[model samples]
Target: MRTHFIAIGGAAMHNLALALHEKGYNVTGSDDAIFEPSKSRLQAKGLLPAEMGWFPEKITKDIDAIILGMHAKADNPELLKAQELGLTIYSYPEFLYEQSKNKTRVVIGGSHGKTTITSMILHVMHYHNVEVDYMVGAQLEGFDTMVRLTEDADFIVLEGDEYLSSPTDRRPKFHLYQPNIALISGIAWDHINVFPTYENYVEQFEIFISKITNGGILVYNENDPEVKRIAETAANPIRKIPYHTPEYSVENGTTLLETPEGPMPIEVFGAHNLNNLAGAKWICQNMGIDEADFYEAIATFKGASKRLEKIAESSKNVAYKDFAHSPSKVAATTKAVKEQYPDRTLIACLELHTYSSLNAEFLRQYEGALDNADVAVVFYSPDAVKIKQLEEVTYEQIAKAFNREDLIIYTNPVEFKDYLFNLKPDSNGMALLLMSSGNYGGLNFDEVKKLV
Candidate 1:
């Protein structure tokens, strides 16, 4: 197949391009701008565009398909030319569905925990030497690319994100994957820019459930009232399996799970992670992995990148960076760290970077989210709000929204770094968690590590 991609330097887009290229397809792509990691990865694969900008001339009659990325505007010249040529164009999710139509698609979906669950499934499958094509959101330890497609693979694991498919395709990405087996971890309203209202945001997941094929299976978190309601009300002809926080105990900074293989210690800790593991285990069971095998394989699993990832640690201090932007994720991460180190003083810092988290109305949802932290700090860039075209937020507004009078807030990165450096490491063991979807404006982790 000959494929061309418009705005292909995106995280998922670049991975898809590489997957297609590796699948023996003649792949080419163009983007107006490409950033690090994506650029380097594409270059390494010889899939990077010769130049950075789109060219209408690149869309030719021989191109079999054009995969569109969310980053592309509707008026992109390459996209216009592809349309003019009457060539098949697909959003990233649409193309994925097309590629995996013959396979049993297992899509893991939720506002959060989707990546971790998907990664766990992939990790277990790899450990068992189960060959399957997959597409996960994060870079796993052994995976070459986030996406993999093959002609003979009978199964495909997809991290089902509820975000928009593309600028032109208004549908949520998860709705495109008509999974035979699906999982929804939890529901919390997000992507305020697209959904606008909480009700509107939830309707997307409902649509996702409806899209599942007949006789499909849905494994959802029973603890979340919203998810439970949706799973129960869905009229689709499918099996609904509800899971919750698994049986586990934390002792001496270690979490062990009670499984058929007896008690097994796992590197990843936290109630949310345990919940994710249970969901992954059920999905694996459906795929023919026994409880004992799942437990044995999962015991060796570390974690997905940036999800409570330990960056630096010492006797006195431990530092972690997490991709936690939503209120639920922030709360879960904070509580997890505190539970793991009950005697430690937890100093948590969260960055309000996502569109939903930056919204004035959504900010209130963060009330008591960071209450688990002994000292909580919130950071937001004024420039970020301006870039998002959101209502200006003041430190007082955030402080009031969180309902924590003692909360520390920073609008400047340098000052935040200065404050961190000035604090002496607690003698009684302290945990420092820096949570955000984005790096805190290029804050130097190595420098922070040295200071702490």
Candidate 2:
């Protein structure tokens, strides 16, 4: 089959392009701008476009399929040309469903923890020599690519995201999966730009649950009230299984998970991660992995990239970086770090980079998110707000939204950088937590490592 990609430089799009290339499909792609990792990987696979911009001539009648990416706008030149030719255009998720329609699909969906849960399942399967095709959002240690497809594998594990499938497709990506087995870790209002209202955002998940194949299984988090309510009220015929955070204790910065056999030591920490582990265990069990084998394989699982990843550590101070821009993620991560090292003074810093985090109305959702830290700091660039076309958020608004009188706010990157570099640890050791989906305005992580 011959497949052409409209905007192929996105994280997920580039991986799918590479997977098709490896599968012996004649794959070609075009993008306006390609960033690192995606650029280098595509170039290595000989899938990178000859030039940067899209060429209408590339959309030929000979192409069998056009896989559209979310990065491409509706009026994108390649997309427009493809439509003009009346060629079949499939959103990434739609194309994935077409490829794996024959296999049993296990989709992990939630506002957070989906990546970690999916990664854990893959790790356990890989360890037990169970062959399966899979797609996860973040890069795992053993995985070569974020996506894989095969004709022989009987099951496919997908990290289902609730974001829009493509600019032309208004449906959420997970709605197209129609999974044979699904897991909803938790529901927190996100992607404010797309859904607009909290109720509207939640309705997408309800639709996703409705899309499950007949008599399929649904594994959900029982601890979250909203998730519990949704799972119980669902009218689908699928069997519902609820999971909570397993018994675990953090001892001297190492987390030991309680198992039926004994205490299993794991590299990952935090209550959210423990909860993710519990959900992954259920999915793995349904996929033919036993509880004993699941615990054995999960012991070696470090974590997904940028999810509370330790950047630098010393005897007195440690630094961690996390891809946590959402309100719930920030709160959970902050509390986890504080709990891990109770003797240390936790200094939590967050960068308001995403459209949701920058919105004036959405800012209030972060009330008391950083309360666990001994010192709370927030940083955001005014230029970022302008670039996103969002209303300007003032220092007072942020301070008031967080409802912390002692909040430290920085609108300038220079001042934030200086504050970080000059941080001095006192008699009580300090733990630094940096949370954001973006770099702190070009703040070099190398310099951050030196400080720790």
Best by lDDT: 2
Clashing residue pairs, backbone N/CA/C < 3 A, model 1: none
lDDT of 2 by residue, 120-198 (tens): 9999999999999999999999889999998899999999999989999989999999999999999999999999999
lDDT of each residue in 1-452, candidate 1, tens digit only: 99998988999999999999899999999998999899999999898888889899878999999999989999988889999999999999999999999999999999999999999999999999999999999899999999999999889999999988988999899999999999999999888888888899889899899989999999999989999999999998999999999888988788989876567789999999999999999999999999888988999999999988998888778888899989999999999999998888899999999888888888999999999999999989999999999899887789999999899999999898888888776678779999998867778777767754
Angstrom error of the Cα, residue 281, model 2: value is 0.4
Candidate 1: segments with Cα more than 4 A from true spot: none
lDDT, model 2: 0.94
